[model samples]
Target: MTIQKTISLRPYPRGFHLITSIIEMQLAEIRQIKAGILHVFIQHTSAGLTINENADPTVRKDFETFINDLIPEGYAKFIHNYEGDDDMPAHIKSSFFGNSLQIPITDGKLNLGTWQGIYLCEFRNQGGPRNIILTAMGA
Candidate 1:
């Protein structure tokens, strides 16, 4: 069986945020899925998705710091600046982390590790609500 749904997450600050619970809440149908895979894809170029530490807040904060430092805003070389200084850098950050993620499903639930969680990698300083398409496939 296969299922797909698009969800909109509330606007979040420019940072990596744990959205595992929000994603799980949208997957009520997954409880019937004994074994499967969940594909989460972000619809915007300025934002992305990832999986990482869910236990500590520092991890997420560190992610924002590291990526921002690595890809600072307002680089004089960027050509896509109509959206603002964060435009080009956001797209670059999105590519590094990616726009989608695949997670194994087992026993009707996400088979994530104890500290693993889904992350909404919001790169734009004022990114609005982001849309994510969730696709689950299995028997």
Candidate 2:
């Protein structure tokens, strides 16, 4: 059987990045299903998903900085100006990363690393709500 869950996040900033309820969602799904694969998906183009360190806040901050450095804002080469300066940059970031992640499940629990955590990567600079989808397959 496969179970699905969705979570909504309200970001405070346009380009604000944050780790969301992926852990909780996975736990909840594990409680219902036993021994399976967990699939997490972000239903947005300007955002993405990744598994990273959850023990320290600095890890996330450093990742954000690295991504920003990799894709700086206010680039003159961007042709998509439909939203704003951060519009095309958001797309680039999404492309570089991803919109979904898959994790293994074991004995009704998510098989995550000691410091591993799932995060929602918001690239757009528009404070709003984002939706994340989590699906689990198993008995």
Candidate 3:
């Protein structure tokens, strides 16, 4: 069986956000998937996705702090500053984190670890609503 859908998330601030609940709310179709893989892909190049700690908010904050220090906005060398100083750095951060994630599905539900959850790495200050494409495939 296979199911695919595109979902839009309300805009979040420039930080990492846990979106597992949101994704789970939209998985009614996958309730019958039995055993499968859920492939989540972000539509924007400046924003990306990952699976990480969800119980601690500080972990998300630390991610933002570290990535920002590594790729601070407004470096003199970036040539793709058409959008803003955050644009190029956002792309670079997105590359570092990546744009897609795959989670195992068992018994019609996500098989995530105790601390694992989906993260929307909003790279830009005003990245606006992000789009994510979800695909589930299995026997």
By lDDT, the best candidate is 3
* Rank ordering of all candidates by lDDT, starting from the highest: 3, 1, 2
List, residue by residue over 34-134, the lDDT tens digit for candidate 1: 99999999999999998999999999989998998999987888999998999999999999999999999998899999999999999988999999999
**Cα deviation of 32, candidate 2, in Å:** 3.1
Question: Candidate 2 — worst ten consecutive residues by lDDT sum?
Answer: 14-23
Whole-model lDDT per candidate: 0.93, 0.76, 0.94
Instruction: Decide which is better by TM-score, 1 or 3.
Output: 3
Residue runs of model 3 more than 4 Å from their true location after superposition: none
Q: Pick the candidate with the highest TM-score.
A: 3
What tens digits encode model 2's per-residue C-alpha lDDT throughout 1-139?
8888787776645432445354564447577666788888878888877888877878877877898988988887888968988888888898888988888888778788888877777787783687877788988
TM-score of each: 0.97, 0.87, 0.98
TM-score: model 2 vs. ground truth: 0.87
Inter-residue clash pairs, candidate 1: none
Poorest 10 consecutive residues by lDDT, candidate 1: 74-83
lDDT of 3 at 71: 98
- The clash count for each model shown is 0, 4, 0
